[model samples]
Target chain A: MDAPTEHLPNVAEALARAVDTRASRERDLLGELEALGAERERLRVAILSLEAQRAALDPIEAEVRAELTSLDDGAHEVLFNSLIAQRAAVAARAELVAEAARAQRDAARETTDNIDALLVEYRQFRDVIEPTLPDLPATYRSVLKAHHDGVVSRLRQFFSRVGADPVPLDAPALDLDVVIGVDGDGAEAVGVTIAIPVSGDVRAATLEGAPELELTLAARVVQAIYEGLDAIGQPTAVTAFGDHRGLLVVEVEVEPTDRADLVDQLLGIMEDVLGTSAELLAAGVRVRALEVPADHLFPPEESSDTLEDAS
Target chain B: MSEVAPEELIVVPLAVAAERLQIDPFEFMRLLVMMGEVPATLQISEALIDRVRAAAGIELWWAEDVLLPTDASPSRAIVRAALRQLLERGFVGARATRIDNLWRGRPEDEALLRRAVSLLHREGMVGMSRSRAGVVVSVSPAAVPQLDAAVRGESMPAALAALA
Candidate 1:
């Protein structure tokens, strides 16, 4: 006889609970996929309707053109002169028809493009979720930890590549502090602060003489970093400090839990961001001695001590 | 019947009058004789003559002459005839005066000097000094070089004759 449900081991109950949760999520995703399919069909019909509307104007336009040409050729000048008012009316109507046709064609093209993008997105979502949905609830904790680790690793790689020292992060336990919820509600966040020493040339100039040039360079650097983070679906807050003792500090704080796989994508995004810096460096704005601050390296309780020790 | 006082009659210095007409004082007196209008000559006050002479920077004291008496003044018809003769023979135009100096001209010559002053004032070449003696005038300092250039050579003689 099968074991009684009440007497089943706690581990077995947990396994069963995970399986049920996965099944429920899979069902929800399938429903969403079905809705998306319907939406795609509706879009396809909308595009066809617009195309047909555009085609319908073509015959009327052609008829107007024929009449205009007949008037131009002077095949029936007496009749044409008699219908001069009608000819003008027809010309105006033709122009309006042509305009409507162009508008319709443009609408149809735009709708088709939007539908294509939706389809691509739906397919990608389907591919990702189909194989993983069953195992997601089971590996949820480990996955979250892996994601965090991956983000930190990518950040370290980014710092190393950019000649910056990574500030050691002493974040709380991943399970307790960083929650990667199913509905994308979580506190999984990472903050990276890098100090880029202002080059001798940039530091030599007074801010009063060429303010915009210096500020714009600093702004561009920050914008490049922000763009990189945004592209990877990592919501980031960026702050850039003016040269303090010849150091230009940029702080980037990212919420990795906002999207899945964002941590894995961070390195590539940061590389792109660093590409702009590389260009800036090539243009004679050298940024060196890139490092994270002691405060960022230690927990709040130990941060002061760490800083003092470093000093 | 009317009686005229000598002081009431307009008397001018001969040196100033000759300078106004741009002719030598003795030459002008000779011209008056040739016109059959020989003027009665009278000496101007020494102080007045010296003041005008010094102001005008005229060192040729011998060039100074007696004023032609108004009682024996030449008629306009005779003066006009003399001017025509002078122009036919050619004469220099009037010289510009200093600011502190007074103008002296015979009745017929007064109109010509007045017109010359008006032209200089209109051309912004002279500044006017209002006085009971009449509107005393002088060439502007800036216009001195221009006046000098205008008077160079025999150019003034022809220009003055044209004015006549």
Candidate 2:
């Protein structure tokens, strides 16, 4: 028996998780930015201190100059030379301080640029994955649009859904067999079942409006449908139709919750997956509600042992 | 944005992870996915993912059996699927197609074209047909190995391995 537990969290939970993750990342970025700013300030303070020392030396140089002029000619020359030497030393020290400040500022700018790059990457990643966000990052949306548009073109060129007109494709054509169904309660949600056929040259085959085909051809059709749907997060069931041609029809069924939007989403995903230039002209594929009725939904009663006995 | 401590933000590069595991970056990523070390919804092509996993040191991908280097170049979809599996296993952080261009094909590579089509058929990942333009491969989750022997290959003990 399955243990009873709470159901999975809904869209709200998903949104909350996204928000929390973004918040944490933003905080980290902010911290790095602050550190960079502080380092720049410290460098500026050191530059100011050097300037103060240079200012204090100016008056001392003037007083020494008067004393030098008052001494004997040889003694006066020595005093003047010493004072000039002291001024030169102070100038060199100031230059070193200024160089240090310039280096620090450059380093701080680099640190800020790195942080900006990281933040940009994070933002792009967020836009691609989060569905609830009002808009996606520009690059992501562009890629999706190009892919989606291509898929739509392909869908229109080949297959027709219920009540929709089929667009023409100049290439050799084949139509896949699919079983459509909905759960009991007349749900608008529908599913499709497809059978795989044993053998055929699909490239050479012409559209015959047949519901079944040889074993190989059937398999190829099912494989195509499966690939198309899986790309869009929609899946179908494939099963053997009968032993006559080793035929199998692929089936895809959606549940009640997504029933309303499933077809549109499926169509969109299929077009994207095909990456074709053909347009999808039809809105829906007219499926008989009775063909694969919900009443036929059964328990697993057909035994392999029973089949073996019959064979 | 609030301030975060320096220790809170850490970057893990693919090359660095590959080196740490003593394998190619791809192979290590596969091991991570199979181990369920990351989110399950992450999507990537299987061929690239398998290559990455193999590069990272995880040998014995299913694609190894069905298609050879001679048959066709594995498709980007296969690589993406492998990446998705890796993400689920927590071997890598995440996969974004825009960020991961390593597995994408270059022009004029016919071998990659054939191998990808064949792999797509065998794995049932995508239902794309070969055309004059090329083919599109389906991306799906990597199959989890059911036995320790299957995973450990010839050189290592299965018991030492971790399963997510």
Candidate 3:
């Protein structure tokens, strides 16, 4: 029995944010925009306050000096004490105003520090939300695509190990399609299957009207790819068939990465085991790339045994 | 179809009967149908072992002689049938083309036969002769041992030992 995808929260709506990478990017842009607005406002207010303090510094100093000088100039036996007291009061009020402004600047600095920490968390929030979001078709598609590429990369490494060069292919163009399936009662996709299509052609005879021959060839190709994959320590479940047009289609259980290059490598193995292209053509076996039915691509792992090898 | 083996008969399918007799499956099908061994529907190709035991000079497949112990390919079986047909009739043997004409598109058995013939010839199990017979193929002297191993599904080294 398969495990339900309940652990993947909001799975049906998984790609609500993750799928549209543009949306997450837009969110990042919004965050940066907000940070910019806040910092700008902070700097603007701080700058205005600094200007106000600088402007008030001169006036306060002049007022204190003028009052003190008057008290000094008016020093007399009876008035001296009262005038000096008034001077001390004026100086204390000016110092209190300056100290309050300094405290306001310290408070502004602390707020900026808090905002800085918030911006760090906002970026991390983007990171945290992505994987926790439910998985959707696009998630599988992208991962399968990577897995497909990894298979090609692995194949290339395999060839390089032998100091041999394979017939280069635009491997990304090779199909490793992920098929999303929704259960009968489930509202969204719950399962996936991987498809890898291969083309089979015969130079001498047509397999179009010959279902048995097509199936035979299809079986051979499947055996070839299966062995190739196993040789690389990448054994996987597979189902393959030949179509009415005598083309071959393969489905494999989903994996973290693909061994898709086995399809390409298989032609080489077949050519070696069977013969050269001309010899193969004479024997009515031609391997190439082609399309397959989307409807048939995603059979379950057990399906390979059920295809009924009529050959 | 008058001959009968001395051994007890066992239940098996017509195809297995054909395999056991070293005869082509289609030819065996025809032989069984003609002798009223196969039903009209043709869906049921199963019959008693006695039906096949009734067809040949020898004690037939499972009778006190060696019967091939493994599942042989249809093509290999066809090749054997061709040899048996010539031996029964006391002929030198027939041309590959003659077999092709008789078997074309009948389940694509001709293609299989062609590959089989090529492989057998390459392995020196089929001989070519000229002159009085005027260019025809006959089973090589080594064919029996080689084909014995062939039908038994022997491994390459053991099969090589058989030829050696």
Candidate 4:
């Protein structure tokens, strides 16, 4: 072995041999891989054939499913139509009942409204004729209407004396709405009772008058009545005594309260309107302060007092 | 320190010299004896004060500049420089003296005194004295502390006392 010459064919020759070995192994691996690839191709083709068979049966399967679905749809449509017809029948019956209820309600409302209208008419009728009814028999509806008229007349006379303008009787004045019972017992004597509103001041001015002036005003009242009756053509025959004058000796009737009001009305009329003063010139004017026999001529009717009382 | 005769020794108190020169006593002594206001001994008395006062009235003398004592060396230049600085700063003033031995080589030292007077005026420490002399100056009740403060550049221990 005499040392193989020439450096054993250089490093390139050694590297080329190793590459050729790797290339041979790679070619053998390529051959085996080509065989495996051929087998895979066959298997893939078989799977493709099976997939084609499954695809070929898809339409028949879908047709059968569709036939079943149509059967179900036919049954459901029958049931749904039957239910819709039943619901419409029930709703129509309920609507008829509701319409009947609405008609009944409308009739009830109309009946209530007609009753209210009749009540209003009756009230209006009552109001119109109530005042005249008091002059009728005791069986008349109520006595308030006739008594109200008398009070209203007195209030008018009071205002005229006090320099207040006469207003309509229906004006809203707070007054006692009196109710006077008619006797109707055929003596033809009509008795009156004043209602006298609650806590009203009928004698307030008298309470404020001095005792002497109160007596003096009473005397003046008697004189004025005598003079007023005489001036109105009801010639009053007055009889005089010691410090006394009698307007009426017999059949003279007047409440002290009423006489006071009458006196105030007369004096107010004289002083406020005519500026003429009237005085008593005496002490207390007692109804029985002086005695008189029944021989005097009495005042006839149509005197202002009689006329005012009649009204 | 020779034992010279008393009259020749000029034994006037330093305070009298200060009054004559119208300066602070200590400062006048510092300018006269210690600093050598003269090259030779000189007499000092009330006559010297009269001389100085007459010179002050005539406007012929101001005492602060010439009265400073100095060394025997010939360094008159240094003394002159210090005097010039003092004059510029208003610490000294010049005064005229007799050229003979009676008042020779003594500089008037009225700077501190003039300043003290001005300070008194500023502090309202000088008041008018109604004497025969017209508008004479007398010490006001404030003189003690104010003058002391002006001299010492510090407030005095006691304030001005009320006059009896």
RMSD of each: 52.8, 46.0, 46.9, 64.9
Lowest-scoring 10 consecutive residues by lDDT in candidate 4 chain A? A241-250
Over 4 Å off in model 3, which ranges? A1-216, A234-248, A254-279, A283-286, A290-311, B1-164
* Candidate 2 chain A: 10-residue stretch with minimal lDDT: A280-289
Query: Which digits, one per residue and each the tens of the lDDT, describe model 1 over residues A1-311?
Result: 98677764699889999999999999999999999999999999999999999999999999999888644333223322323333233233323433443454355445344433443444443456446656667677566546544443433332223221111222221110000112222366555543332221232232222222232233334443444455654422332233322334444445645443443343343344334443233222322222222243222233222110000
Task: Show what share of the native A-B interface contacts model 1 retains.
Answer: 0.00
| Number of the predicted model whose TM-score against the real structure is largest | 2
Indicate the residue-level lDDT of B62 in model 1: 16
Model 3 lDDT tens row, A1-311: 98776665686576665767778799899999999999999999999999999998998899999888655322222232332343233233323433443455355445344433443343343356345545547777577556544443433332223211111221121111111121222232112221212232321122222212222233333444444444444433232222322223333332333324433344454444323322123223334422222333333222333321111
Report how far residue B103 has shifted in candidate 1, in Å: 78
Where in model 2 is the C-alpha error above 4 Å?
A: A1-179, A183-192, A195-245, A252-256, A263-311, B1-164
Separate DockQ for every predicted complex:
0.00, 0.01, 0.01, 0.00
Cα lDDT of model 1 by residue, B1-164, tens digit: 01322112223334444444443333233233223232222222223333434443333211236232232224322223332222232222333232212223234454554555456567766566422122235556666555544433212222333343
lDDT of 4 by residue, A1-311 (tens): 69766755667888998899999999999998998999999999999999999998999899999787644324323432433343233233323433443455355455344433433443343467665666677745445445544443433332223211111222221211111121223233222111111111111222333122222222222333334323332322221211101111112223222333333443443233112212111111111111111111111222232211110
lDDT by candidate, in order shown: 0.38, 0.34, 0.37, 0.32
Residues B97-142, candidate 2, lDDT per residue (tens digit)? 2111213232233344335434533554323332111122333334
Compared with the true structure, what per-residue lDDT tens digits does model 2 show for residues A110-142?
534444444344445445634633487788777
Q: Which residue window of length 10 is worst by lDDT in model 2 chain B?
A: B93-102
**Which model, 1 or 2, shows the larger DockQ?**
2
Q: In each prediction, how many residue pairs overlap at the backbone (N, C-alpha, C within less than 3 A)?
A: 0, 74, 1, 14
What would the DockQ be for model 4?
A: 0.00
Per-residue lDDT of candidate 4, residues B1-164 (tens digit): 12332122222333345444444322222223212232111224433444443432312222456443343322332222222322333322122121111122233323333333344445665443211111134344445444434333243212221110
Instruction: State each candidate's chain A TM-score.
Output: 0.25, 0.21, 0.22, 0.19
lDDT of 3 at A173: 19
Ranking by lDDT: 1, 3, 2, 4
